[model samples]
Target: MATVARTSMLGRLGDMTLPIGILAIMAMMVLPLPVVLLDTFFVSNIVLSLLVLMVALHSYRPLDFSSFPSILLIATVLRLALNVASTRIVLSEGHSGSAAAGKVIQAFGEFVIAGNFLVGLLVFAILVIINLVVITKGAGRVSEVSARFTLDAMPGKQMAIDADLNAGLLTPEDAKVRRADVAAEADFYGAMDGASKFVKGDAIAGILILVINVLGGILIGTIQHGLSAGDAAQTYILLSIGDGLVAQIPSLLLSIATAVIVTRVSSSHDMADLIGKQMSLRRAWVPVAGVMALLGMVPGMPNVLFLLAAAGAGAMAYFSREDGDEAVEGEVMPGAAPQAGGAAAAPAGGDESSEGIVPEDVTDNAPISLQIGYGLIQMAGGENGALVSRITGIRKDLSKAMGFVVPGVRIRDDLSLPPNSYRIRIGHRIVGEDQVYPDRKLALPGGASVRKLRGIEVRDPSFGMDAIWILPQQVTEAESDDYVVVEPESVIATHLSQVVTSNAADLIGPDDVQALLDNLSKVTPTLVTSVVPKLVPLHTLTAVLRHLLAGRIPISDLRRILEGLAELSGRNLPPIEMAEALRPSLTPLLLQQLGSITQPLPLITLDPELEQILIRARQAGDLDGGLVVDNGLASTVITSISEAADKAAGEGRTPVIVVASPLRRSFAAFLRPHMPDAIVIGINELPDTRRVEVVAVIGGQAGIPAPNGAR
Candidate 1:
């Protein structure tokens, strides 16, 4: 009974916290506060303001501190209530001296202002000017503009979320989270715009309160207390200015905090680190050192101070250069490929390789790794590593699409690679290797431009489009010529994304599939328990999922996939056959990703005669695998399909090939090596709800035929 009572008592007290705080603030304004309590409250106010400022500086994004507006309002109201209470004390006790109001006010008057009322007043005025006219005003304006823009962009942001969801780049749960963040962001800025007025009003109220206290104190001291005019002026004026200073300093800090929050851009780093990294450029510091050294030599300058400043800047430059070098070189990890002839000589005994071996010596365990040459190292290291952030985003998006978390990419520098090259590996196999120029931009020429740009021509690594390696300064000129300019880091990141996405099947394993089942059990426990390892073994289920992924099918709807598997459990089919059987139910997912339901799906179809010939060839020769056709016929069919796919691509449409259901899987597999980009679907997989537009008919010389209407 005692323990229960104690728990109940704590919960009740927690519930009363807000109401109690409100009552205390109101009492501060209505009743007289003892000197000790007033001093404590004054100190508490300063501490609260500093705490707020620190939180604002450390917040990675505005939404990270979404309650700041409410907090700001409470702090402003508390400050105003303190002002009212202090004003009462100042007016009633001024004749007694500066210590009459509180020790905090007295300390500000004597210690801060050196017992000079004039200095205290001047300092308070400057603080008020800074808080009211500069920081508070600027923060309010920024809040207003940010709120307006955020609200204006809400529709577009929501549409983008929906588009990504439909495209399978975001799961429904991820879309919901993104939508909530967007709405919260809009509400935060809107609240911030209104809360800024409280800060402005607080600054104004401080100045007015100070003026009133000073005027009232002097009148009461001289007339009612019968003090001399100069004595009243000296004593009362000091007390009033000190009271204002104590309140105004905290108000200034809050104003600066408000400005920091309103003007802050969302970043992964804190304000201090972000600013430090951006300001640590060696080239920028070198110029500053040179200018400072030149000024130190001028005849009228303070040579000692100027030379010291020069030396400081020079030190910063040297350290910045050293930091850059360390960041680049230290990025190489333990798994990096060794340099030729640079391996340590064997010990007095035989080579260690002859005696024993470790796991790392035999194989890399990481699912995905990026190996960059020394010259391209800077793009993947240090505080502002663009490639790192981009790869993180890719993993997140791919995880949503693949229905499981994508493993993190490990980055390392390889000494054996050419200085300007990079290699992307999945497990132990290298998937992509390409060269890039860190100092240059890749400009892809669009067909709309007639003039050729002057630069070294190359093929785009991601898409194999004709591109030029142009100077960074020529970006604007290239854009004017209808060329798309891409950064080197973006080029590398895009290639990595493409490679990972294409080989997504290779990345998933039995363990990953088990993780998917574990997550599914939380929501649909019976389905997971009944289907996985009972109807289908874990490895077989993993193989089925890999086959779907190889066909560019998203497994995000794991519950639906499991339910489908349960219905087919009695057959005891192989993984490939099970996966093929599940495709009809999962076709909507693939179609929605290709295009929206509102637009007709662009399809490339083979001629009826050719389709029958391929199906017959597969049945006669290799019924279990791809169609086995004569070389001459295969060459002719591939050429015709390639031309049609290219034409549709030039017209900005994703071409989907429609084939008979019996030949769909084999034909798709056969075309995988030659036409990797082609998406082959069974005619039955085309839903009746979505319309289809026939873009081309391969292996025929006739005019275009009418598209099959809606399925």
Candidate 2:
């Protein structure tokens, strides 16, 4: 029972350690401490400062020591409190002897300054200058800049996380973790910006306290003890210098630690490993060795010291080269034999050889891919790389608009392409290709340029608009001429975005369908369990979704789609028939995409007689070949619709084709080859809350009349 009570008491003390330390620091400022306790606190302060510096040195990244700001505040307070306790003791006891305060302070005065008060004062001043002027000021500036940049980059980082989530590269949990990290990074830098001010204030406080201690001690010694002026100065000044040094050394250490944390770059390696790897190159050491050797041979130089330094550098260079060669050989000769002429050869049919062989039947292609040539590889990755981030943003925007998660794009280099060209592919087939100058900006004329710019002219890859590639220096001139400026990476990302959106139906397969169902099951388990594999098979639902996606309809509202499926559960219908049956239920979603529901939908209508004729033709099996139309009539209809679409686009409204229920699908199929950008919707697909305005009528001229009973 006694042992158990002792264990419990120890656990409670561990929990209360921080509060106890804080209370003690506060007490030291108000209450007078004995010389023994004062000495103990000063020693502890030195140890704590050293511990903080060591931790900062070993941290791989700033975030690895995220609690540093709080620790900094605590250490600064502890040191100040110790200074107060030491000053009280020093002033009261200096008249007795140099050893009056404690052995710690006396040892610092007698040994560290070599019993010279002037030397101690100069050393203390230098320490104060180094800490306050150089390290503290620089650390404060870095903290301010880091905080500002971190805030500026938060939006971009957030968009990148959303992109990764939409591309299926990150799950919801992983995205949450990443977003938290971004927030934490901002908070840390902001705290560091404030914590640096504490170090600066502490340096100033140290200077003031030193002066106070010396002046107070002199007056007290002369007036109360009746000592001579010179004797008083000798006694008080020595104690003052020792007290200042003891406090300032720890202050200096904390300042250095603060500087180190604010300046460290986030990397995989710690400080020691990073410095060693970068400075251990043979090429770097060889020049140092040659320079040192040359200096050693100069006439008046210290011959022995310079020669010894040169020899050391040469030895380091030789060892670095040998290590590099051994590393290369190890990489090249894994399970390989040494051949003639010192070349390493792979062992035939060995495990290492087998690892290099890929099976011919393997088809490991990304659903979408972007391939850039060698000249643009630098734009794909680095601190300033915009291509990868731009592509990620594109994927996120397209996914939100299309109502489905787009697959991640795989980027690589293809040497067969031209140096400035890039290709976007879906599966194994190239869908779009373009050329962009990585070093120049593309300027497109909005209207007519104020003056013609001299540069290589090309068509915009995504929209085929006429544009000129101009030097970065010409951006001002081009913009002054009313040209819209675009970066090269933005152009490529835009083209890739278009290609992926147009082929969205092809990207979703059985696997993607099942993943979506699994996610839905987590929220509405009963609905998924009752509908899938019971009423409608999984493939049927996938096909229906694909049909909608092919027509550029968003399937993001999965619950609505499943509800529609459940309503028609008993009937065994074909996929196309099911999709047609489900169209009316999805009319609101489609209308929301066009614009606000309060506005009228701009539409082009088909003549009743012409619609009937197309319906008869489709019923008579004309879909397999083509719509039943002569060359002249087909040309006339195509021309009329194209003119109406251009007008609608000019008015900032999407062009939609409205037809009767039975004729909608067939008429859309007929118009697709001619007007790929037009949207075709059935009359029943229009919701009652929406209004319609007929912008134009197709197939209503050249002797084609409306049917008698047509509205």
Candidate 3:
């Protein structure tokens, strides 16, 4: 009980320390104090100033001393209060002598100035000038610039943190901490910017107080106390100068502390260690030694001092070089163990060396990978790097669109490719490759423009449109000319997004399918329990999902998909057949992606006669489930659809191919290779309330060949 009481009492005392100190400071400014108490407070003020300075010097970074601004404000106020108290004593008791104020003031006046008032006054003025003019002014400027730049760089830093989080390099909690640090750093610099004004004002007030104390004391002594002119001058000036020195010394310490903090850059080492390590470079010392030795031999120079300094520098350089060589020799390369014979031991197998060879177990490949050459690697991860963040956003958007979690993209560097080239892979297969200049912006010319840009002409990687790779400085000019401008990182990210979206089916497996089922089980347990594994099994469900994804239908509404699957459970239908039956339930999701249900969906339809011809080909090739269309007819059909797609895209509408319900799956497979961007939908998949505007009819043109004997 006694120990607990003692601990509780200490905690309460620690909590009250700030309020008690603040009240005391305020009390000192208003109330009168005896010489002994004033002397004690003055000494305490000097001690606190020194402590603050020492702390600032030892802090590894500015944020390590985040409370310095508040501390500076309180210290400045305390010094000013002390000044007011001392000024009152100095003016009221000047007729008595310098000792009338306090022993501290007396010692500063007599011992420091050697009883010479003019010398004391001159020294006090110089200290004020150094603090206010040089240190305070420079620190204030640094604070202003640091605050502005810190605020300006916040967005870039936040993007970098988010990129790291999405790239799996940092956890959400780690990113949160980093973001808080960035915000705190900005706040610290801003507070410092404002706190510096307190020092400046204190210096100005010190000068005013010194002048008032001296003049006020002289007039009171001579006129009021009937002292002689010389007597008043000696008495008042000595006391006034003494009080000024006492306040000025602490103020000088604080001013130096402020300068040190504002000029500091964040590092792992404190000021002393940082400076010592940087200045220990042997090459730097060697030049200094040679320069000093050359100067020592000059005519009329101080030969002995200069020559001795040069010898010391030469000795430091020689020892530093030896230490560096020893450090280099002591370093052991990874995987190279020293043997009893003082040589590296061979691998256990003895046939092959282990040096620089990566083991098979160490290579873990991601489902989706983006490998860029060295020149474009900078676009992958930095404050300004947008590729990683953009890819993360793409995955999130596609996940929502496709109704499944998109896997993370593993980004790395490949040195074998050309410096400007990048390759995107889906499960070890290269799906897209392109070149981008890091220092350039790509601008696509939409139509005839008033101005033409001079640059390397190239095709946009995502869409194969005509684009120009222009220097960054030309972006504004190109935009003014109505060209669509894109940064190099955006260009690469867009290409990767296209590749990933098209190959999303290849990325999903049984694991992803089971995860969806597990999530659905939480909401409708019986529905999931009856449909998955019990009726269709996990692999069949995965196949159904991949089939839906290949047709550009979202599986986000999994409950409805399961309801459709449950309806067909006993039928034992193929995965493609199951997907076909599920399409009607997923119509609303697809329609939502297109636009409002009330608005007409722009679509391209196949001619009835052409559709019949394709149906006959599919039926004829029924044994293998592959269409056996004539080669010439297939080429003609692809060419006609390609033209229609180009026309649809030109009119600012996506090329969605609408076919009969029976032919939707087979026709989509046939058109996928020739027109990857085309969206194919079955007639039965359209919601009843939805409207359609058929803009083009493929194979309806007069000159196209008939499919009867084109082979």
Candidate 4:
């Protein structure tokens, strides 16, 4: 400390001679001037410096050839006017002598408060630079929205998919294609995300200026008063009103900066996207800025906060604007390969995706296209009411961890926003009804089904397409209401129609089926080939599948569940018969009980018109290779078998689930001779089903259960 002090002293001594020489020269120049005029210049010097600083700092921006000269000229003129004003004040106030004028001169010269203000501003500037640096250097996929500014910066799904593929979650070819797609998609949006922060900082910079100006003003007043060091510091803080703000220059500068930053950030990206509950709800930066602003006002802490607040505001504005869709539309994959289902086309598949890093398949199409997930979310109002179409864009950006948009899938309208009861349908067919209109029983599209609605008052003559809710109970199954024959592809939407028509299910989640699967897993390993394995309870499983559309249950675990079910019914059941033992009606109905948890269950991906098409194709033999397993056809066939086998033997009514796949046929044939107690059939052959009723079969013909080697 002593050595540093000695060095500073020596440096000061060297500079002291220059000040003395300048003073002597100044004295000579003023020797011939009258005392009043000369004193005026002295007093105004400090004032002029303050004025210049105020003007310079407030209107700062990138200098250009066109505007620089004019700015300088205006500044010069302003300084001159300030000097002239000071002279007039001194003369009119009748103040005299250098002693009294000295006070005014000292006010301009005092650096005590100004020094503190400047130091505070410098600290703020450094922090902003540091924050920007920290953000730019970081990488990875995370939600685009997060409460804390520093805690977000999530790795995007594209990045995540790449990592997963690289880690061997996918095939090489799939990885290559996905990598290209994610890269292009994430890069386009990522650029905008990154650039927005600077605008936020710029906005905050305005607040910084205002804070420093306040401190600077107080310091000048304190110095002019010529008080003791302790008193001068206290005066600026405890008694000052920031007289320099008389021009309100700092505040105006801040306002403009705020506006510009907001505009700039908003212009750069899709801002109205869901920032996740974390960022959009918590607003962490707002408090941080508020605190900093308060501190900045304190001279010691004011400047930093002011700038931080401005920057944060800028960022918020950028992230919150929902205006242009043009930018998002323009963001095409620059050199991306086509997407092939969920596989990557890389050498060793690894690509970031919504479901994490996974391998992808190479697409035969879209070699250079980016796949952006957007929703065609179903919109339904009251019975025949006007449906409000709402589309959520840029939701869950995940890049900044600021949002949680499901990757490659638009889940924006999955959950109800502005929560209220609304009707759901599968085209004209009403599938969901229990919760939709619990009190009203109106006719639906095909015939009549209006019992799902709730929290609504249905009138007797609220006519729309001639449906009536007069009963306030069940919608009588209409004669024309043919079974909704649909394929696996369109299962969810069709099932959703059931919810709309029957009021059979509600929103479901992951834990709904945890119990059923857990119990099922304890019985036998191969009993169930589940899509999602974690589900356990019957209702839970149903609900999970209902929402997620797919779920898994280990083969062993599924047997366990069957065994447990057998135990519940006090029957010694074998694994082969358990699935059949679960009444066909019961199994499908259980999905409704699970509410939304039913998953891993086959999704009906077939189109609404697909059944008709397939039927026609079957008649014309023109489908090339598509099958038609229309609605209730399987059930009606099962009923025929049940009635034939009137003497039932198992749980409720024993069902024979014929192995209709070719793979199972060959295997079942091998075991047929040894295991006579449990019947196994082949697709190519049929036995005397008159004695042993041919109950129900999936994936096959009436007589032939399955092909030789394609179980």
Candidate 5:
């Protein structure tokens, strides 16, 4: 009871700290203070500014210090309040001596400026110019641009998240977290943009306060106290300059902190570590050493200093070379893409010929593997690379969407491939291969671009959009032309993401399904026991789940899936038939992926005559053991769908086709070749809760609107 009461008291005291400090600062502006008390406050002001600068420098990212804007505002107010209090003492007590205001001002006047007001004024002017004109101005501009770009990218980012959620790459919970982070990032930058103005205003105010204190003190000293003109000028000017210097120094430190925060890139390491790693390259240091040695040999140079610098650079180059070689040998695979979290290949171990067909030598059991050529190894191997993080995020997203943990991907180098080429494999089957330049970026042109770019043109590997491989220096130029620029790492990661998501069904097996059941048993043991071998066998359950996954249905709600299966247990249905029966229960999940509940689902439909023809063809195919539709008729129907789906996509809607329940399976199978991404659903599969708009209809002869004319 005593500990609890003491904890409560401490919490209450912590809550009162900010309000009390603010009130004290306000009081300082209005009330006069003794010299001793004034000196302590001056020291405190300097300490606070130094503390803020340290925090800013140590932050890994700007959002890590989200409260910096509020801190900056409070510090600005504190400094200005101190200016007012010190100005009062300077003018009221200048008739006595420079030390009349306080020791802080007295030290700056006597020691720092050597009692010369002219030198003090010059130093103060330089500090203000550096703070106000250079650092503060540049920081304000960077903040404004960052805020604008972040806000501009929000809609696209949100749409990407929704697409991932729909594709089953992200869970609703993960999506929520990503959204909150995006909003916080935008808010942080926006606040920083506004806070920069306070520093600028404070600098201007500092100049005005100095002028007012000097003129006011001299007038009072000579006129009111009957002092000589030169004596009054010397006494008052020294005190006033000293007071301005004390305030300006702290202001300069705050300005530098603001600049550092706005310009910082979001990285896992702080500024020092990131810079250190990036600079520790043997290739970069070797040239510096050579250049320094060359300079040392030139006549009329400082040969000793130059020679010493050369020797230090040469030593750094040697050590850097050793580290790089060790990193490559240990981390990179010689003949395949190295797996991120998998076991490394064993050393030769007394010649492979003598071992003669070792079991581990010829087989890879990993579910997924990535093979990159030697030139691209740096992107997937080094501490400076972002590919590892990107791949990890992809796996996380896939795990949430697919309702199972995606296996770790193994990455290795392939000596037979071209230097810039990479291939992705699922088990032993190659899924995707592409080439990307490590030092260049892929720029996709948008509608706003008024001119063409000059580069090597190709289609985007993930989306098939027209793109160009351009030099890194051309990013700003491309962005100005309204091109969406992407780095090479993103290009590879996106392709990998699409390939893995499309094949999510192949990545799961009986073991994964059984694990899911085991985890569910902890929460609902009765449901698991009743449904597992007693009704649906584990192998049958795995097959059913693979079918649902192939159709892009998430099984995260395993309870609901099991419940639906239990209802049809006595029917003795096959896996395909069982998956079909569960569609209605899962339609709401697909609907959410299409859009929010309030947004109408955009849909396409076949005209009545076309529906009849397809239905008749399917029936005949079942009877004759083959589909007997005329080749001309099938071609016409496919062409019509391709056009409608493409048009709907251009208008920013997901292309969905609704058909009669009897024809859905056969019709979807027939159209899969041409329109692989379009969703074909039985009319009954759509829930009654969703409102849909018919955007296009194929087959126009029976008084139905044409594909181009449908609304």
Candidate 6:
């Protein structure tokens, strides 16, 4: 019933802006007619008229008329039906069959003066309205029913009331005239609605109305009276005028109730109050009824009566709602139904939806299961709110996995980052969320397309955009799509002038590093010095090299390099995913060196022959100044030789090394501390140097430089 009632209300309101306006204009138009005209046609009961009209509107609301004319026709016919019904009731209120026969003369006399004696007085009014509308139809387009209502029936032109223009029917001119009729109707009914005070979210108006009606009813009953026939008739006539105004009060209340009820009903809830018991109806309707009921009742305990009436009406509205298998789509409010997947049958193997994705979207696109490999970061934070602070959560996770007593190193998950730091993307592209897709196929609204940072194409949605997906687009280096640019807020960011560096040591090769860098100036590069800092037992550079070679670079020491980058650049560096990248290639060699720790010769370190290779490469027009670019093989070689030879010579030890190539200049620089007192150059790169006194040859357990065992 609540559903029905509410639906009924909605259906009416859906047409709300119009029909009531028509009724208002009609009533107002007839208002100035003398009492004879009112008594003759309108039939003297405004309250009943309103109530019947409202009920007709409520009933007609659900009818299947797609156009304005159909609605008007239905409403017009409904009004006539209501009129005839009211008349039958009016007639039945009087006497019996014999009295009717004797009253023929009186009936005739009454006809000459009053009019209809059959049925009810309301019937006459319905006929008049119906006749009027029928007559207006023939009046030609020059003057339509709405125009007559405007020009002859009433005044003022408001288009909002009867705007039937949007339905894609009817000419513009007809609609222009129709506006006034619609507005007048709306104003008449809207006035009552505005005065009803029901929809203001609480029932203060209903309470007030109940009070006023009861008191007013009693007061009017008190003020006017008579006992005799003619005198009583006159007294009643006088009271009827006041009754006319006060009678509409209940209709106003009825309007409030009807609207809320009908809406729910149309929504498939038969009653108006399906809003539920958890909510109170008195709170809704009391404003319109409470005070009025109190006013109508005697001043004694009117509040109590008001409360009872409100409670009763509210309860009726709540529980009397229509039930069903059918409900309107929009009526299904939130929290009224099970949440998505909440009640869904659990999938086989329990719920794997811990991440909460639609089952359809989850696929192989998700990341594979893998253990944490390694990570590093270059920059550091000097103070507060730097980029370093946001990492607290990650640190917590990592700290938990590795036990507490590892090295007393504080792995900060947080830093003092700036409020507006950028991820430094290729273009400032924004992908809304995690997608399994790579960007190239994801076209923008404006016909733009994105390409991957690398030429490698991906079709999965997961690989698409990220909040962190900005790259400062640099030129692609060779066949690879890898870009090299300055960091956004780092010291390097301002100088991001190139796509790749001539000397990028972060990528590869312990062995290659030695071969590539052997000829560099005696000036040391930070990579070797920082990792193998010269100290006593710790940094004897030998033990340190061994430790590092064995992959025992402590977290404390690793953090120093990270701190240096930060101190040098004053920027937020991301956790180095690149450091972990190194572990795979670097780990094996480190392990091998560690296993053979007992060899006194320290054969793991680079000899001068390898250093000579780097020097020749440098002198062979292959070096870019002191740096090597795009030479992974060369860079790796230089780095390895530099590290090995540096560690050996740190103890003031030297090796008689073979050399041929243009490396003499570079070797002089690399071995500056252990400046070899005597060198037996390798006979291979040397011309007949076998006859030379100091020939360096690698033989037996190890090679030694003999002083002229030749010649």
Name the candidate that leads on TM-score: 1
TM-score, each model?
0.70, 0.69, 0.61, 0.23, 0.62, 0.19
What clash pairs does model 1 have?
none
Kindly provide the TM-score of model 2 when superposed on the true structure, using C-alpha atoms. 0.69
Cα error, candidate 4, residue 414 (Å): 23
lDDT of 3 at 331: 10
User: lDDT per residue, candidate 5, 1-711, as tens digits?
Assistant: 999999999999999999999999999989998889889988998999999999999999999999999999999999998899999898888889878899999887776578666887788888888889999899999989999998898898788778666645555777899889889999999999999999999999999998998788888998999988888888888888888888998999999999999999987798888788767878889999999999999999999899999999999998773333322212211112333222234455764564476665567777888887777887887565566667767776677766787877777766567989999999999988999999899999876888788888999998777899999889999999999999898999999888887788899999988878887887899999999989999999998888777767777888999999999899999897888888778867766776677877777789888888878888878742235578877787777777666666666678678899878777877875655556778899887877777776777332234334322
* Candidate numbers sorted by lDDT from highest down: 1, 5, 3, 2, 4, 6
Instruction: Kindly report which residue pairs in candidate 3 clash with one another.
Output: none
* Model 3 vs. true fold: TM: 0.61
Q: What residue pairs clash in candidate 2, if any at all?
A: none
lDDT of 1 by residue, 2-97 (tens): 999999999999999978998999999999999899999999999999999999999988889999999998898898899899889888887888
Q: Count the backbone clashes (under 3 Å) in each candidate.
A: 0, 0, 0, 167, 10, 129
Identify the superior model by lDDT, candidate 1 or candidate 6: 1
Give the range where candidate 3 is weakest over 10 consecutive residues by summed lDDT: 326-335
Question: What tens-digit string does per-residue lDDT give for candidate 6 at 412-437?
Answer: 11112222221211112211111111
Question: What local lDDT score does residue 80 receive in model 3, on the 0 to 100 scale?
Answer: 91
Once all C-alphas are superposed, what RMSD does model 4 give against the true structure?
Answer: 22.7
lDDT of 2 by residue, 512-548 (tens): 7787788788889999989998888898889988888
- Cα distance off (Å), candidate 5, residue 474: 25
Instruction: Please give the distance, in angstroms, between residue 260's alpha carbon in candidate 6 and its true position after superposition.
Output: 6.0
Residue 693 alpha-carbon offset, candidate 1, angstroms: 13
Which regions of candidate 3 are displaced past 4 Å?
Answer: 1-15, 32-72, 87-123, 138-196, 212-246, 249-419, 424-431, 437-459, 465-490, 503-599, 605-640, 659-675, 695-711
Per-model C-alpha RMSD:
8.1, 8.8, 10.1, 22.7, 11.5, 29.0
**What are the per-residue Cα lDDT tens digits for candidate 4 across 1-711?**
999999999999999965674554345333443435544644443454354334433332211111322332332333333333333332222122213323433343233235454553354445444433333222111213211221232355556565544333344566777666544434434432443343344325434443543355345544554445554443332111122221123222322322222222212222232223125422455565566556667756558657777677656645642322111111112111121111122335665454543342221121111112111112221222111111111111211111011122111121222222322333333322212222233443332333343223332121112233324333234323521222111222233322321221222223434443443445544543332332234543353234212111112123433444544333434323333333221233233222233222111111224324434535454233233345455444333333322322322233333333332323232322322222232222222222223332222222223222211
